[model samples]
Target chain A: MSALALFQVVSLFLMAVGFYGIAFRRSFVGMLICVELLLNGAGLGIVAAGQLTEANPVLAQLSTLLVMGLAAAEACLVLAIIIVVAKRWKSVDPSVVSELKG
Target chain B: MQTSALVLFVIHALIIGVGGIMAVASRSLVRALVGLIMTLFGVSGMYLLLNAPFIALMQLLIYVGAVVILIFFAIMLTKAPAGGEEERPNQVRTYLLALMAGVLPTFVIGWVVLTDQPASINAPLETGLKALGQGLMEPYFLAFELISVVLLVAMSAAVILAFKRRQSR
Candidate 1:
């Protein structure tokens, strides 16, 4: 495989790892960490795709920046919500914090 | 040249794999967060290898600086008893669903990679701060402003959600 292709493969592996964490993590904070991993994986994929496609480098970088910003905003919002839930339920375990579940 | 790239790929893959395992398997939330940070760092390295320095930097700034810190604060403020009842799969069906959720994306991505011939990597890194600024303020200017508004709304909402009950009490 080419260098770029190799990078892409590694990126995908990271993405998979992140997904696995997201699937299995029990705590909300742990899941949030996994989400960060997933977002990073996506960012890496975008960068690799941009490298492979020289046609629009600027666009790719801009999108990557946007993703980063979005991830930051998302983390802030989710963390705040998680804190609120923990405050009320006294637990971060999703299994137990099911008051809203139908 | 190819050999060096392959080595880097192997190293990055190992980092991601180990970090992923640590993040998922560890019992401590803080340790899991650390593992996640390591995994993100590996991804940023991969981005650098892909020749997008700006994106890599953003990865560092946003994921490492902002997101990870947010998680840390959550862990600190929340009173969740660490190392409580082991997180068991609540049901067989849920376990199966989770497994499917994890496997489906991997298959889709694998199919795309295997079927599509690897594209050539001839593009030199063209993203500099100037170009990024130009694009952010130009064609995507409206979207950029919109994102700022979205962020404002999200921040205020988060603050309100987190503190509303406290103030009421």
Candidate 2:
């Protein structure tokens, strides 16, 4: 297999790892970390596709940039939510957070 | 395909794989954060291998520098910085679930990746950078500006949410 394909596989694995983390992680922040992992896997996939394929490489780089920007915004908001949740619920575990259960 | 490049790629792959495993498998929040940093650095190295120095630098600066620091502070603020993170019930079942959830997609996607045809686009090296500049300056300009607005809104909303939560004490 080509190196590109291998890299793509690695990215796919990262996404899976992230998905698993999301599925099982008890804490909200752990889930958030998993989300970041998912995003990074996607960004890496885009970058790798651009590098390997003859398609518009700029598209990949630009998308990765956008992903990075979005990730920053997401981290900011999620951290704030974690702080609020921690204060209100006195626990960061998502399993314990059930105020939205309707 | 040089030997040196192959060696570097091997090093990077090990870093990414091990770090990712540790990030998810470890129970400690601090250890997980450390693993995440290691994974991101490996990712940045991959970006360098992909020939996008600018993106690599951005990954290092934004993810490694800003984002991780923010997470660390959040951990401290949330009272879970050092350890004592809660593990969910049915540890064996969760492990089984995680394995199933992770492995299935990897298998499916790996098959497709192995069978897919190669890409056929042929753009010059410098042109990619040029196109990015044009995109930012023209077609993508509005989106770029909107991103700033989104950041502003998110910042304000986060502050408000935290303030409201604080006030109800």
Candidate 3:
């Protein structure tokens, strides 16, 4: 495989590892860390696609920036929710968080 | 020619592998976050290898800088009973589930790499930065502005949620 292609494959692996952590991690914080992993994987994929396609480098950069902004916003909102949940329940385990569950 | 690519590929794979393992295996929540950040930095390095330095910088700024720090703050504010000794059920099952989740994507990616025709490596178009600016300001302007509004709303909501409740006694 080409160097670029190899890099993409590794990026995908990193993404899978992140998702695996998200799927199994019990704590909300752990899951959030996994989400970061997934987002990084996505950023790597976008950059790799941009390079391989030889498309507009600036567009790729800007789009990635947009993704980052969205991620930041998401982190803020989720952290708030997590804090509220922890305060109410005294734990951050997702398995026990059932306020919204029917 | 191919040898240099192979060497770089090896180094990239090593960085990603080590970082991924660290992210999954770390015991402390903060340690896990650190590992995740390392993985992101590794991915950004890969982006640099792919010739997208700008995107790499964005990865560092957004994922490592903002998101990870926010998580650390959340951990501190919530006072997560640290040391990672909480007993969670189904240890074996969780590992099995993680393995199952990883299988399909790996197979699909491998298949694509094996069967697909490779495209020639050309000089990337120079209009990327300019076109990106135009696209952001013109086509995606509304969405961009809306994102700002959403962030403001989120910030306000967070502040309100975190405010202390008054005692009735």
Candidate 4:
């Protein structure tokens, strides 16, 4: 396999692991960590594709920067939500805050 | 690929793999946060290997410096137990389902990647800080401005959401 393929495999591994974490984690913060991993995998994949394929490297890097910005924004919002949940519900467990479950 | 680069790639990938597993499997949220930091560091290293030193530095500054610290503060504020989360009963089926759901995409994409090669490999470009700045200020100016707006909105919303209020109960 080429070096690029190896990088792609690593990205895939990260994505899969992140998805599993998101699905398995019971707490909001844990899920948030997994989401960050997923985004990293996505960024890695984009950069790998741009570097290895016939795409514009500048655009790829730019897009990854945007993804990073989005991740930061998401982390900000989610952390705030987490704090609110902790204060009001007195726990970070998702199961404990299941009022919307039907 | 050169031997040195290959070795470095292996090291970075190992860091990411181990860190990601720890982040997911650890019971303690604090330990998991540490794992997340390790993974972020490894990802920045990969960015360096991909010829984007600026992005690598940014990843370190933004993720490790800013995001991780924010998470740490949140953890301290929430006061989650240091002993870690307790396991719920009867979760085998759920675990299996989640595993399958997660692995499916990797298998599908890996298969395609193995079977079909990319048409051509592009030479790496030296995207200096100047070029990146010009690109952001020119062709991608709209996206740049929008991202700033989005971040501002997010910051305001976070403050509003986390603000304390007098509750008459």
Winning model by lDDT: 4
Name the regions of candidate 3 deviating beyond 4 angstroms.
A54-56, A99-102, B1-6, B85-90, B109-114, B117-131, B164-169
For residues A1-102, what per-residue lDDT tens digits would candidate 4 score against the true structure?
A: 776788888999999999998888888888888999999999998888877777887888899999999999999999999998898889888889999899
Q: What is the TM-score of chain B alone in each candidate?
A: 0.84, 0.84, 0.75, 0.88
Better of 3 and 4 by lDDT: 4
Which regions of candidate 2 fall more than 4 Å away from where they truly are? B87-90, B119-131, B165-169
Using DockQ as the measure, the top candidate is 4
**Residue-level error in angstroms, candidate 3, position A83:** 0.3
Off by over 4 Å in 4: B84-90, B120-123, B164-169
DockQ scores of all models, one per candidate? 0.62, 0.61, 0.58, 0.69
Better of 2 and 3 by lDDT: 2
lDDT over C-alpha atoms for residue B79 of model 2: 82
**How would you order the candidates by TM-score, starting with the best?**
4, 2, 1, 3
- Candidate 4, residues B88-136, lDDT tens digits: the string is 4437987898798789987998889767877545345557888889889
Q: Between which residue pairs do clashes occur in model 2?
A: A54-B121
Clashing pairs in 4: none
Q: Compared with the true structure, what per-residue lDDT tens digits does model 1 show for residues A6-61?
A: 65666676677667767776788878877877777677767677767655777777
lDDT of 1 by residue, B1-169 (tens): 3567667767877887788778877877878878887888877777766667777777788778878888889888875466443345356765567677677897798678756755666435556789878988888998799888888998999988987755453
Per-residue alpha-carbon lDDT of candidate 3 for residues B56-120, written as tens digits (9 for 90 to 100): 67777777777878999987877766644334445787789987776667678757864673663
Compute the DockQ of candidate 4. 0.69
lDDT of 4: 0.86
Name the 10 consecutive residues with the lowest summed lDDT in model 4 chain B: B81-90
Top-down lDDT ranking: 4, 2, 1, 3
TM-score, one value per model: 0.88, 0.91, 0.84, 0.93
Top candidate when judged by TM-score against the true structure = 4
Docking class of 3: medium
